[model samples]
Target: MESISPLQFLKDKSILVIGATGFLGKVFAGKILRIQPNVKKLYLVVRAADAKSAMKQILDEVYVSTS
Candidate 1:
């Protein structure tokens, strides 16, 4: 018998996450990226003045702190 890791399911998959700036959403995003580094993509939908600001916020608040 062999055991399969649940993380395997996420490999090479695209994920769209809304409200990623919130507490639980941030936790979920961090965990997914940390556990499955090979995930195809992570689309974080955030509310901001513009696309640039959204990207900056995600980079600073999520990726920077988590990584």
Candidate 2:
């Protein structure tokens, strides 16, 4: 018998994460990225002035610092 990894369920799938800048959200996002770097897509919902600003904030505050 072989064991199946739950992470395999996320393969090639797109994930949408709300509140991705918050503590739990950031942890969740980091875990997902770390485990499944080849996911189809990741959409992070964040609050900001515009789309560009939201992306920048997430990158600078969450992704960059964590990485």
The 0-to-1 C-alpha lDDT of every candidate, in the order given, reads: 0.87, 0.87
TM-score of 1: 0.82
- Candidate 2 regions exceeding 4 Å error are 1-4
Looking at model 2, report the run of 10 residues with the lowest lDDT sum.
58-67
List model 1 lDDT by residue over 1-67, tens digit each.
8886869889989999999887877899999988999999998889999999998989888786567
List the candidates' TM-scores in order: 0.82, 0.81
The true-versus-predicted C-alpha distance at residue 12 of model 1, in Å, is 0.9
What are the per-model C-alpha RMSD values against the true structure? Answer: 2.4, 2.4
- What tens digits encode model 2's per-residue C-alpha lDDT throughout 1-67? 8886868888899999899898888988899899988899988889899989998889887887458
Q: What clash count does candidate 1 reach?
A: 0
